[model samples]
Target chain A: MWEYLNHKNGNVLAVKNLRGKNKEEFNYSQLNKKITKASKGFFNLGLRRGEVVALISENSPRWLIADQAIMRIGAINAVRGCNSPAIEIEYIIQHSKSVGLIIESRSVWEKLSIKNQIVENLKFLIVLEDESFGDFLGWNTFLEIGNKNTSEQYEELIDKCSADDVATILYTSGTTGKPKGVPLSHANLLHQITNLACIADPKPGTSVLSVLPIWHSYERSAEYFFFSCGCSQFYTIPKFLKDDIKQIRPTVMATVPRLWEAIYDGFFGALKKMPKFKRNLIRLLIRNSSTYKKNLRKIRNIDLYETSFISKLISLFLVIKSLPLHYLASLLLWPNILKQLCGKNLKFPINGGGALPEHVDLFFESLGVNVLVGYGLTETSPVLTCRRTWCNVRGSSGQPLPFTEVKIIDENNSILKYREIGRIFVRGPQVFEGYLDNTQASLEVLSIEGWFDTGDLGFLIPNGSLVITGRAKDTIVLSSGENIEPNPLEIEILSSNFISQVQLLGQDQKNLSALIVPNMELIENKFAEKNLLEMNQDFEIKKYFKSANKLFIKK
Target chain B: MKLKNTLSQQINYLLKNRSGSRLEEQIIDLIFVEPFSLENNLLTQTLKQKRKEIEKKYDCEIKEMYKKQIKGEIII
Candidate 1:
């Protein structure tokens, strides 16, 4: 919480004013005053210690202020995803039992903008930027009340908060129904941020450009991680990722694999329209560069910063000229590449949120940017495992962070041996307090032994590496009663440039059928390159089916 | 490409004009688009695309393609 304030105080937090292309930067002192006001305001709004206040806003400085202010009041803040549908939004407000809501009125929240009508328990609606809270007391009035409160009163409430006091309730994107609110405490969050900071090791003044919505745990932990390291953080309101990145030239960032995949697909799609020889040459360069880097990683690992003089001289020569060839490739490809996915010179790109394709990780790793693949849920304070540049593992989620323990358990509650696939349970300092208001659900996942059942199936490698196969809930059972891991096959199909999305369908069928989304541009460009323009219709499906027929084993 | 109003429209336009034959007129077994999300699949399934929906949904991929083109790829 203090780190967030520090980030703002330092004049480095770029709140992309979506009203126009113009962005406003905040210094530590200016931001802290607002945070302190926000804290006082929320307290004056009758927010008591242990009460919950729901925050509904897009990415903005006010959002952070409202969030941290609730923490300062010893009240838990429940954050809803900005893109949440109305029904889901209402469900969150009800489930969280939020006494009040802090909202920023815009086209996005206009549908749910009815004050007090949607949330019966809601007492006040504090508008952040505008006086659009019709027939309601505005945030400015609340600010005045907070200003009137003695500093001693504010400090008393803040000092009452212990590490165990719930800080926030983050609702997971429930693919099925009403989202589950994961309740994390101050200690849970700080511990996770500490581990993440250790893993990424961002330098002081490291600039981080965040694309993933701060509503998500991945970005939330990352925001704090950057803060703890004294790094600068910048974000645009709503969505201005592309413009923000070029302007920021961020030293570190975190994103899901889809962003990286889009960059890869866009590059190849454009290349397909190039002259055949030129296209082939670029592909050759990518392959050669990957191979060369793979060898360099091996050489570096062997020497351990003690390279022989001869090898060092060879490296000097390579750096002087030949190595710059790939550097130029990065320079040429990265700008357009960043423009494609709206990212830039991110020093370290951490991947989480879902299972990431190894090929996707390697593609960026090949580009000389260290890509760290991590694993966690909102319940684990969000970060459990993260890879470093030197000891990176492509497919696995890397080793558990310091002070985190992992165990695989069988049906009898027996711990499985290493390299054996079983249910994954994690014990760590940062595990969440529990799901908000869902005592039954919380009991089911969290055991008395402090192991949180991750509901993910995987095994630790013989060398103690975590390999997540698939969600236990997503496992497909065959007629022979054998459970099949669908992720491996689905991941392979997803790796194909032709297939965009894949979901395996078969509860009892002889074999699985997939709902596949084809990359039309890639297929269309391929058709154009192959002189098969006349067959553009159904070309993507045909090519994919043809490729699948050759590779997939027939049942 | 701006001559076309929508991405699916541009795609159909390309298919119709490519090789001087209207491929859209042909009875095709299936139409495929790389589906990144459930929303993408829904949009592709809708035979006619709304300019706003297509533009908002596929903005990232489309802009990425445009950037690649800017870097000198000849789109057939």
Candidate 2:
């Protein structure tokens, strides 16, 4: 880790605490200063080296400050999500047995106060944000304390630290079950960044727009990657994805599938609302495009186009229309219709934290956006497979990062053949050492050979690209032993223009019933075109039911 | 001038001076006359409208949407 930092010395590591339109850039020197001040403040509060200090916060400048400061003091920084439910938050706090808790806001401290009844390991509360914590002191005087620290004291702390010491205890969202505390050492964090750098290859001075609720592993991984690449980071106000994208025009962005879906929905929704001629033209062009691409692929495969004039004409037309269509698509849809996709300065957009819906993957590719899907678990220091510049297999989550070895293991622990579905197991230097102090839980997932069971069912395609099938836990099983994977079905539902979200219920039931949230505008237009009433009142539900009935009957 | 007793009566009272046969047009007129009075306390109180309670109890009113079947529009 020291060697890595030494290599990246004097380079801009990260930008911190940015908001609104006025973008702020923080370099390594600036970050170093903040770390020194924070460490001095921690020392003043009687925090020693190797002590565990839990830093609970949403993404803020202070969170970064405390993160680097803990490293300076050789103390492990336990970063708990600010909005985690009391039980989950308490689990992390108690497991780490932190000497002090550095909270970002009063709201987080209040939530912790209730959980204190069950877990009493946290001794001191240091409020990073200017908020009143009940029975705890506020840190409104950070300026005075930070300013009092000398430069010599700051340098001394940095000189005394080692790379083998624990850096942070990040709690996974645990979509499967109980959230586990992943203790990442400085070496672990550095290795993950290095592995990410090998694939992402983000350039220095690249502006990154981050709004992934920074408490999550995806955002943290992205931040580390950005820092490693010497990029400037700019964050936005929560729920301001569209405006922020346009404002920052970030060279890179990291977001989830839902964000991509929202962007698609926003664009497509506006397209649906356009006058009949325009909509029909777009549909016709898009349909023709698929046929055109298929013929082009066939021509390329057979070499029939090598000498024929007709084939040369066909190739000329493809070249003429393809880039023009992309440009026109951006022009027509991106301005008002696709505002969220207008992070025009973006060179590489990393989609992770959840399954990147295949429809979304196709949509952006069609529009000429370089949307790359990556896969990982929090226990694997997050990024396992990622896309690269030279090559990409459209649907697969790219190749494994450098030396990360990925395999599919069957129920009996036998390795599966290519494209045969099974559990994904990853072994790498980037994998977390163990679940913080939970040996039983650690051993359940992590093998002695360093292979960690990702619990995600996926298969490797012939090209060595990984395609995630579904979560082993999220699979629904019926009483008669019919097992249904919901992820593919959810993806299908999400792709439908009328549908936003769908959850299938069929366990122990005769048939599946889906709970769906329909896009009101699409449904309303369909009703209007049918000379029927809108889907506003309860009585209007019958019209939709009839529509569905007709649709399925035709099928 | 007396308060309308029936929903149709009140709806007509609201729509009497409005143009167009559609409910959307009538609602537009009603809204323009009131100018989102429910958004303001003094205006709603002055109009003697218990907007929150009315909206809470009535789904259509809350959503400001009503679907009435219209024939002869579908080309098929």
TM-score of each: 0.69, 0.68
Residues A25-105 of candidate 2 have per-residue lDDT tens digits of: 556766666666777877766676778887777776667767777777777877766665555666666667788877777
Task: Report model 1's TM-score to 2 decimal places.
Answer: 0.69
Report the C-alpha displacement of residue A128, candidate 2, in angstroms.
Answer: 2.0
Would you list the C-alpha lDDT of every candidate in the order shown?
Answer: 0.63, 0.61
TM-score of chain B of 1: 0.36
The 10 consecutive residues of candidate 1 chain A with the worst lDDT sum are: A477-486
Interface RMSD of 1: 17.6
Two-chain DockQ for each candidate model? 0.07, 0.02
DockQ (0 to 1) for model 2: 0.02
Candidate 1 DockQ, CA atoms: 0.07
lDDT of 1 by residue, A1-555 (tens): 564646544554433343322245555556667778878877776788999887776656667767877887789878865556666677778788888877665543576644456556766677665664563455566677767756576678888889888888888655333568898888988897767766678766677776667777778888877766767667753245555666777778787665566566666777788899988877866765565565464445422233576776665554454455577777776456544444455668777766565565566666666677788887887888777666775577778888999999888989998667899999999888677778899999999989999988888765456888655565553222223344444455455545565454332222333444566655555454443333343555356445544544341
